[model samples]
Target chain A: MQRYFIDTAMTAAPGTTVTLTGEIAHHIVRVMRMAPKDKVELVFPHQQAYVAELTQTTPTVAARLIAQLSFNSELPVAVTIACGLSKKDKADWIVQKGTELGAQAFVFFASTYAIAKWDPKKQVKKLERLQKIARDAARQSHRLVVPEVRYQKNVTALCQLPKDQGVVAYEEAAKAGETAQLVQVTQQLKPGQRVIGVFGPEGGFAPQEVTQLNAAGFTTVGLGPRILRAETAPMYYLSALSTILELQTPVVQSAYSE
Target chain B: MQRYFIDTAMTAAPGTTVTLTGEIAHHIVRVMRMAPKDKVELVFPHQQAYVAELTQTTPTVAARLIAQLSFNSELPVAVTIACGLSKKDKADWIVQKGTELGAQAFVFFASTYAIAKWDPKKQVKKLERLQKIARDAARQSHRLVVPEVRYQKNVTALCQLPKDQGVVAYEEAAKAGETAQLVQVTQQLKPGQRVIGVFGPEGGFAPQEVTQLNAAGFTTVGLGPRILRAETAPMYYLSALSTILELQTPVVQSAYSE
Candidate 1:
């Protein structure tokens, strides 16, 4: 069944009728052409998911809630992928793929060696485009939450964000043979903890940028021995996190099983 | 420093001269615009990487071997990513990214639900293009080996490929909440073992296909709960392998450290 993220809060009680309007209604009525009694998932605020059967498709689109869903696809620990702004569609690619891979949020910041500069005039438009991509990817991946996309002016501003732990992906660290930090840090994380992983652009981070992040309490770590591209690093980080946190754990009643 | 995979076997001892011609020479001379005495890393056929300095740049390009490097960037276990042929540039994307993530080989096979079809006349040319992509990605990522790209006619042909272990990435297995197989299989893998991971296309596999693979001694594994696109699943698999095999192990002298 197709899933939609409903923006508003709805009663959690079963058998309640929920009406969807605007883009959601248009998608259900025109795009999907879902008929009465057809089932679709509606995820409300606070990550509550439900199975709902369509009651009407013409004039208005509405569905009657069936039962609350028990399984969640969100990562056990929330991850914020903070990267230096990159050129062209690289950011777009990152957001789309990152959402599917289970990142809780994304942050793009300016750095000394970053090739792409975000224009002040068009920054909102650019962010809106990325936000839309995240939404679409989240829906396609059956995720209950759409990751928020944000921008910071520079590395200092990025460092100000609150996180339980922060790790900067420095090539020099990898080059120096610092292979244990990533595994060490990820292994210690408990459920509900937030982590921010900082990555560089095509040209990589300037030495001082790494120093500043280090001063601000970010540990320097390497993804692996092979040098991953700027965009590829984040995917590697997320995948590693999933492997460590999710796949390595004992089996549970998962989202898909429901 | 840049790296190139030299196709032929060369003298591994230092203080020897290696000649470069054709595309590799063109890239070093014309694209990089290197002068005499500039250093570059040349990887020989047996995965021996050596630091060499340019001797001439005119009618011929030659380099004198400086020293033999001890670091190895290839994954501890050789991994072959076998995916159902996807449409457009998805295969190209997979080969490039997968190579960087440390896949030793890639195989694209025709499957029941695959939308893309490869013409027999153009198959060889298509493999050449993917092979080139793997080479470029391997060089960019400083890998010692360029992953071989191959094509299989069907699932049976894919299963017949030699491997110490075979895993089929099934969404149904994920949906059924079978999450322990991937970790169990990967945890038992010893260094130098060969493993093949098979993935489906956008439409996924037919029931019979899964049964066929299961009967062939391929274990069904779930990557994670979230749904990954046809192109994205291979990356996830490779990244997970790197995480479990490389990051989770005790620290040692790594390739980048050299």
Candidate 2:
């Protein structure tokens, strides 16, 4: 069954019919050629999923909520990826993959070395396109909610975003073999805490920009020793978070002590 | 300074000169527009990096080897990524990002659900192009050597590849919350041992294909809860390995026990 993220938070009790409209209706009817009796999964605004059975297919599409599904695909700690605006394709790639990897939101800002300049005239259109990519990716990945995408004019504006914890993926930290800060921050993270990680553009962050990030409470951390590309670093950081938070088993010291 | 991977096992002893030919020569002379006395790094077949100064830029580029630099960027354990052949661009993305993340080799085999079929005539050309992508990525990431790229006709050939340990990134394992195998395998990995990981294509591995991998000594391992795209899974696995082997500090259980 195909999955779609619905915008309105309507009750999906077992007997209620939900009508699909706008682009989603067209997608189901024309692109997918879905007919009455076909099945689809609709994700509600509050991040709950329910199976739906199509009841009507002409002119518009409608489905009845069959059952509610359980399982939170979202990460325990919400992560917002803040990147210095990169090339167009790189930005799109980050949004798509970041959503699949369980990012809560994505924020892009213009850094000192950002090669791709954001046009003030086209900002809304560009942001909308990126948001669409996130929605589609979230659907494909079976994520409960679509990650919010936003753009900022510069790093100063980016620093204002609220997060319980902030970290920066700095290449110099990798060079200096500074690995403890990430571990410290991630270990201190509790479920539902918001972490915002900022990465530099292809040219990386300038010294003054790093200072600003430091002043704003973002600790610089290394991904690893290898020189990851500007685009690759964020993925590395996100994966690290998942490994530490989700995958690793807790250390039971008694066994080791013996 | 720029870095170039040289094929021949040439000595880069101090005061000795090495000549660049073919594509690498053109890249230095034409693309990079190098002048005499400019510095460049040369990586030989032995995986040693040397700082060299341009001695000649005409006919064929020549450089004088100044000193041998001694830092190995290769992972403690070698990793080979075996993926079911996916769409053309996805396969390329895997190779490029996998190289940057420290994959020692890449093997693409056709799974039962693989949508892309490799043409016998174009295999060599395609493999070469992917190999070039890995080489460029290796140089950019300051890796010691380029990862080897290979094509296999089916999963059977992939099973025949020798490895110390084999693991599959099975989606079902994630659903079952099977998190121990990857940690177990990576923990027991000794330095220089080879580990091969197999990932499915867009449609994923069929039951019979999974059985085939199991028979070949591959242990299925889950990445995490959220779904990962075919290209993204291998990078996640590699990053996990790096986090375990390179990034994390060993737990001091004795101190905690007290």
Candidate 3:
């Protein structure tokens, strides 16, 4: 079934007719050509998903709620991927893949050794584009929520953001054979906690930058022994996190359970 | 410091001058512009890494072996990422990212639902390009070995390839709440074992294809609840494997140890 995220909430009970307007309505009525009785998923605000059957498609695209979906695909813990500004297409790649991998948000900041700088004039446009990518990826992945994309002026600005825990993916940590920090951090994560992971650019973090992060309460950690490129580190982190938090624990019985 | 993978083995003892030629030499001389006494790491055929000091940069780029490196970045278990062929740039993206994530090798095969088909005439050139990407990524990630990229005609060809164990990422498994198989398989993996992970294309595998793999001793596993792109699945598998096989165990003291 096709899924669409709607801006408004569906407060009425099941069997109530809900009309979709704007882009989503055009997509359903014109692009998908969904007709009466065709089932589609409508995700409303607050991450509620419902299965709705199309009732009227001629004058407007509308559907009546069948039932709510119970299977939640979101990560148990919310992760904000904070990365140093990098060169072209990397940020876009990160947002798209990160959303698919269950990140709750993404933050790009200029660090001491960052090679790319977001132009003040073009920052909004770039962020909007990234946000769109995240939404598309989220929809494709059947995620109820789209991860937000944000920009921080510098490392200090990134540090000011609130998170339950913060860890910086420092190359020096990996080079120094620091292997336990990342696993240790993940082990400490509890459900619903928000954690931020900081990563560097192609030219990794400077010594002083790492120091500042350390002073600001971010633990320096290594993803592994191998040198992951700037963009690869976050994916590794998210994957490892999901493995540890989701797969390793006792199975959560949900609608998908046999 | 720079790293290069050399074609020939260096059997000479320390202090003996070894000459480098071809692309490696040109990269060290023209690209890096190194002078005498500069240090570089040269990896040999059997994954031997040695630090060498430049003897001369003139006639040929020559260096004297300074010492041998004992730190191995390769995963404890060899992982071959077998992916159903995807559309343009996805294969390239998978090869590069998979190399950094410590996949031992890559195999692209035509599955029942694969949208992209490799032209027989263009296959070799495409493989070469992917192999180059693996090499560059290996160098960038300070890997001891470059992962070999291969093409298989179909699922049977992929299954016929030797591996101690195999797991296929199945969307149905995830939807059916099959989460234990992957972690169970990872837990069962022993050091030095070879494991292969299979992923579907954008269109995903047909039901019969999954059955065929299951008959071939490939256990179906879920990466997570969220639907990951075909290329992203391999990265998740590799990263999760590394986390389970490398980070969860006791840290091995290496050269960087204090």
Candidate 4:
């Protein structure tokens, strides 16, 4: 079922009127064609979601709470996908897919090898659009939490992640170990811990980049025998990480974007 | 480090004449634009591979072995990928990528919901073409095995996997357990095991299909929280499996690809 996030204040006990705002209002009323009495799920951050039906339309649409208390699909491990900046479509794909895969946050870093440049003035706007994608994907995938999407200056600006473990995906790291990637990552991971992973752009990381990450205590790792396209590699790790952390393959109605 | 598979026999000696035939000959001569004395590597099935330099050309190029050693890049586990035939070039992408990820075999089965159809007479030719793709991708990814590209009768035939461990990649499966996918697959897997994993078309498998797999000893699994296009799921699994099996990341090098 398609669920929308709303403010906790908007929700009332069992049956009451509440208004959606901004993008949510525009999306529910305009894009999705949702209207009066149509049933949908509304979630408030950190609270159990409720089933609501559209009751009215105005500056924002009004919905009445139909049901409360239920299960929401949330991953056991909170995943943070930190990706270097890339082409527009590719970046869009990463954000959308990463959200659907249970990413709690995404860090977009502009790297030395990145061909696409972002002007400082427009960086915030650019990030907003990407965040919109994450919000939409969260609803579609029935996620309990919508991913926090943002931008970073470079690797040094990497967020002080709340994750128990973090990994830097560098292909060259393979030569140094037969089981180094798994060992480092597995060691850091305790069951039910959130994990953050980083990936480079198409040109891959400079040798110094790996050294820097190693110095920062981010364990470098490789994917496998094949050379995956830059976009594919991080997504691959997200799937595996979620599997390990959650301890099950989640099968729901397929809901995601490119 | 581009390695060519030589179907022809090699003399067990230092100085000898080895003829390159078929597509390999065409690629070396026309594509690589090689003249005499160009260094290359060739491997005979179940034999030591060697470094050889081109010695002659025209119809068939001859090369002399410069060095010989037992070499292999085969993964410990043998993986078979069965995908529902799809329309939007996704199936082709799966074949190419799965080959690179060390899938030992591939089956393009016609599911009840499959939109792509093939004529009976051309099945062999189609599989042959797909086989060539696997061969090319194998060389590019430095895989020791070329996935056996084949087709199945339909979903009925597919339900009976001619392999040991079976997995059906259904988004629906992931929801049933908090983390059943990785737990189930990991529990079943041991070193050097051969397993078959199935994926559905964009439309996905029916409830009956999931039940059939359960009855037939196949576990229903979800790729992740994301709704991957039909092509991306299997590749995601293959990449993760490689990491898990190897217990480490792979070395990335530009020299290996064709």
Ranking by TM-score: 1, 2, 3, 4
> lDDT of candidate 4 vs native?
0.72
Q: Which stretches of candidate 1 lie over 4 Å from their true place?
A: A249-258, B249-258
Residue B243 of model 3: what lDDT? Answer: 83
lDDT score at residue B148, model 2, on the 0-100 scale: 97
Task: State the lDDT of candidate 1 residue by residue for B1-258, as single tens digits.
Answer: 999888887566799988899998999998999999999999999899999999988889999999988888889899999999898599999998999999999999999999999999999999999999999999999998899999999999987888888999998877776778887788777788899999998889988999998888889999888988888888999998888777744334223111
Computed on C-alpha atoms, the DockQ of candidate 1 is: 0.43
lDDT of 2 by residue, A22-85 (tens): 9889889989999999999999888879999999998678999999988678788889999998
* Model 2 alpha-carbon miss at residue A239, Å: 1.2
Candidate 3 colliding pairs: none
- Could you report the DockQ of all the candidates, in the order they appear? 0.43, 0.45, 0.43, 0.24
Lowest summed lDDT across 10 adjacent residues in model 4 chain B is found at: B249-258
- Residue range A114-140, candidate 4, lDDT tens digits: 777778999888889998898888877
Docking class of 4: acceptable
- The CAPRI-style docking tier of model 1 reads acceptable
| RMSD of candidates 1 onward, in order | 5.0, 2.7, 5.1, 7.5
Per-model i-RMS in Å? 9.2, 4.6, 9.5, 11.7
Return whichever of 1 and 2 wins on DockQ.
Answer: 2
Each candidate's fnat: 0.53, 0.48, 0.59, 0.37
